[model samples]
Target: MPTLSKLVCAALTCLAVQLPAHADNTDGSFQTAPSFSWWSGDKSANNNATGGGGVFGGRSLSVDGLINSAKNLIGLPYRAGGTSPTSGFDCSGFVQYVFKHAANVDLPRTSRDMAQVGQSVSRDNLRPGDMVFFAHTRGGGNRISHVGVYVGEGHFIHSPSTGKTIQINSMDSGYWSSKFVTARRVTD
Candidate 1:
């Protein structure tokens, strides 16, 4: 239920108050923020230090900003048709909100609809901020039933299904890597 600016401020406040002690982040993992715990899965494997390597993962770009904004909403709940941070968000809703609010890009409402736009990219070609899609079924006929914003390395940020909060997941291994239908570079 926290806004991006508010979250940023809160993060800054936490940083100021805890400036003397930096948590040991020696591994390629992050524990995510406390407030974010409510919204994300908070898995160390997903928050690996590599953060999912992407072609444009280096030197933050506008897309990188969008990626960061989505990552900040790590602890929001999933609402069936929700799109805002306060009410929570679904997979597509999460993608829609991030594009609209962060990059000023207007995307379709449904994950399938979104899959239709943008330039198609191979899994090996994905860059930070590209839209990644998944089909719930593994059948060749299955269509895009879910979507997320690619955040680099092999991770993505998405508001998962009911009872699940926004979280990051790996694209190189796991059910996702298998269900991945295709990726699209929605932005330059």
Candidate 2:
């Protein structure tokens, strides 16, 4: 009988072989460059959830990096229409700055406008770095008025209203949960 180590390696190798096609080049070429080297190789250091081998954007910034960058602003005063760490940030301003810095992606100035783009993601399907939206109306409305970056585990980071600072809050909070709208994945 085969040893357990060999059997496990064989199983992972089979699973890795089923991965779908990947974009070939920087411009997303269709060329197929094939490899499953990670399967049989040492995986002791692999911890990335996406299974891309811990590579963030493969050279661009990773979502974790974006979360870290956003988290660094915690305690920065909230400023309406503000866009920089120095000037502080509103909800949208904070989102804009973090996306620009982390992924080189430019988001709209206001939360509502930012909601228009990107793939629509359900709140239940939220992933780290995904954008969560909200409306000011107590009962919730179609108009989105606030935004935050979902940092996984039902929490998000944002520069809340006046008198608040950039902070992370549980989306499951009574107030937020009631006003919660759909989420979007700009990084996807």
Candidate 3:
């Protein structure tokens, strides 16, 4: 029997023409091409396949790649309106940058606006690329005040606030759990 890698390669070869032109995105990153569709009943939705690993007929969305890219920015400082690695990133800016580069999806600039783009996902059902939202109860109430990328295993990465750098935090922690508002899945 052929190995799983070989089977996957053969399948990708057959589907190459149907895949989008990502020749410039060869560095283990993905770009959004709506032609890409998820396989039905995906058991690996959270698998984090490195080489565009979750598309129809072949690897198409690299959850692992997106996560890794986000991880690489762990020490960057936070700025209110920052968006790039050099200028530092705010909560939403960080999420937008990662999805745009690592996953090839352009998200809205603010966390509140970002919350509106994707489908609602319960905390229990979160996958790796799901955007998690939180609210500051004092001033936020039901309004979203923060956002992060759910990196799986109950952990998420974000630029918490001023004087803080991008860091990963737990979804189950008292602070985040209490403030949790909702989550959205913008990637497959």
Best by lDDT: 3
Per-residue error for 54 in candidate 3, Å, reads: 4.6
Per-residue error (Å), model 3, residue 85: 0.6
lDDT of 3 by residue, 1-188 (tens): 99999999667545643546343233222222112223222445446534345442333667767776787687789999999999999899999999888756777899899989858999898877788999974765888989998876676788888887787666775467778889987564
lDDT, candidates in the order shown: 0.70, 0.70, 0.72
RMSD of each: 8.7, 15.6, 12.4
Error of 2 at 136 (Å): 1.4
Where does model 2 exceed 4 Å of error? Answer: 1-61, 138-140
Worst-scoring 10-residue span by lDDT in model 1: 52-61
Models ranked on lDDT: 3, 1, 2
Which residue pairs in candidate 2 have backbone atoms (N, alpha carbon, C) closer than 3 angstroms, thus clashing? none
* TM-score for candidate 2: 0.68
How many backbone clashes does every candidate have?
A: 8, 0, 3
Higher-scoring candidate on lDDT, 1 or 3: 3
Provide TM-scores for the models: 0.70, 0.68, 0.70
